[model samples]
Target: MNGAPSTVWFDRKRIAPNVPEDLESIDPMCEEIGKVIQLEVDQGIPRNKIIVGGFSMGGCLALHVAYRFQQEIAGVFALSSFLNDNSKVYKDLASSDCRRPPLFQCHGKVDPLVLYEWGESTKDLLIKAGVMCQFHSYPRLYHEMNKDELDKLQAWIDQTLTSS
Candidate 1:
C-alpha cells in the first residue's frame, strides 16, 4: 500500500505465461505481495487493515489477486490496470453471484498503453456484475500518476479504512 513502484524480477513459479498451454500466468510478484500481507496479518494486523494496490502491470495483478483471494482482503486499489484472464476471468467477473470486495480504480484519459477506454470498460463490467466500485479518470494525463489522482486515492483509502 506504499504507492511506490516495485521492480523485482519474477521466478518461474511466480509466473504463468499467457501461452497456448499457459494462458494464465501467476505473477511471482504476487507471491511476494501475499507474503507481505501474511506477515502483517500474523503480526496482529487486522485483515481489513491491510490494503493492496499498484500501478499499471502491478495494478492489474492487484485486481487479479484480490479477486482470486477475495475472502482474504478488505479492499483493493488498482490504477491504470486491466482485469486480464483469457475468458474465464471475464465470465467470473460478469456472473451475477460474484461478490466483489470494495475496489478503487484510477486511470489517465490519455494512457497509451492500457488505454482509458479499457478502464471505462472494466467499470462497466463491474457495474454489470453488481460490483461496488469507485473510479476516476483524469483528462490529459498519461500512464503515470498525477498529484490530484494520488490525493483522491489517499482520501478513498482513508474512508474505506474506517468503514465496515
Candidate 2:
C-alpha cells in the first residue's frame, strides 16, 4: 500500500551474481536503476511524486540514487542499509547541491550484518546535514523489517502521497 498512489517500482533483472568477485560490477546495477527512473520521467512522471527506497542493499542504492539524482525523486525510504564509502559519499551529500528529500530510515537494534551503529551513524550525518529525515529503531529485531515498521511506513507513504 505504501507504493500505491504513484507506484513506479524500479527493478533490475540481475546485478551480477551478488558475489565478492562481482561486487565492483554493481555499478551497472545502479545505472540500470537510474535508467528505469529516467525512463519513467522521460515518459512524463513528475519528479516530486517519485520516491526512491528499498531494503538492505537496495536500500543503500536508493539513498545513493536519491543523493546523486536528488532533483529527480521526491523522497527516500531506506531499511537496514549502509553508506559504504562514508568519507566520499557522506562528503558528497554534505556538499552537493541536491535537495534533501523527506528521508525515512528504519533499522533493527539487533541487526548483525550492518549493525545498528551503521544506521545510527547515517541518521546522525543526515540530521547534521539538515535533511528532513525520520529514523525508527526496532528493539530486538534483527537486520530486517518487523510488522510495526511496515505499518508505519505504510502510514507515512499514505500521508505523503495523499497530501500536498
Candidate 3:
C-alpha cells in the first residue's frame, strides 16, 4: 500500500506472464519504501533491526524492497507472493555483491489467486541467489491468512530480531 490500503501495492491491469511490468508506477512505490528505511535509520534504528514484509501483492512488494533496496534489513516474510524477471529487483538480486537477508515465506497449497508454485519458485530463486529462506505451506488454504500463519510469522520475526 502507498499512503492507502490496497489489494496490490501498485496499479496493474492484471497479472500475465508476458506483459511488460508497470515500472512507471512501481519505481515510485519502491522509492517510498526506501524513504521509510531512511526515516527509520535517522531515528537510530540499525539497518539490521528493521524488517520489511507483506501479504499477497504486498508480500511481493516487501520482497522487492528488502532484497533490492534494503538488503541490510533483519529479515523479510512474504505470504503468497511472487516476482517477475522484468523488475529491477530481479536485476539487483542477480548481483554477486548483493546482501541476502533471512526470508520467511509462507504460501497456501491450494491458493487460486497467487498459485502455490509461484510462491515456491520465488523462494527457490531467492535461495539460489544465496538468500537464507524458510518456506512454509499450508494445506488446502486459499488466498487469505490464518491464525497459524500469523503465529509462525510472529515466532520467526521474534527469532530474527533477537538474533540480529
lDDT of 3 by residue, 14-117 (tens): 66433566777777788999999999999999999998999887887888788777888999989988776465666677765878889999999999988888
Task: List TM-score per model, in order.
Answer: 0.77, 0.77, 0.89
Model 3 ranges with Cα > 4 A deviation:
1-7
Q: How far is candidate 1 from the true structure (C-alpha RMSD, Å)?
A: 6.1
TM-score of 2: 0.77
lDDT-wise, the better of 2 and 3 is: 3
The candidate 3 region of ten consecutive residues with least summed lDDT is 12-21
Model 2 scores what on Cα lDDT? 0.70
**Clashing residue pairs in candidate 1 (N, C-alpha, C atoms within 3 angstroms):** 14-28, 16-25
Ten-residue stretch with the least lDDT total in model 1 = 12-21
C-alpha-based local distance difference test score of model 1: 0.69
Quickly count the clashes in candidate 3.
0
Per-residue lDDT of model 1, residues 1-164, tens digit only: 14445553222222222322122344455676788888999999987777788887677667766665543577888888765324234565655354467889999999887788877776667666666789998898898999988999899888888884
List per-prediction Cα lDDT, in the order shown. Answer: 0.69, 0.70, 0.83
- Candidate maximizing lDDT: 3
- Best-first order by TM-score: 3, 2, 1
Pitting candidate 1 against candidate 3, the one with the higher lDDT is: 3
- CA shift of 103, model 2, Å: 0.8
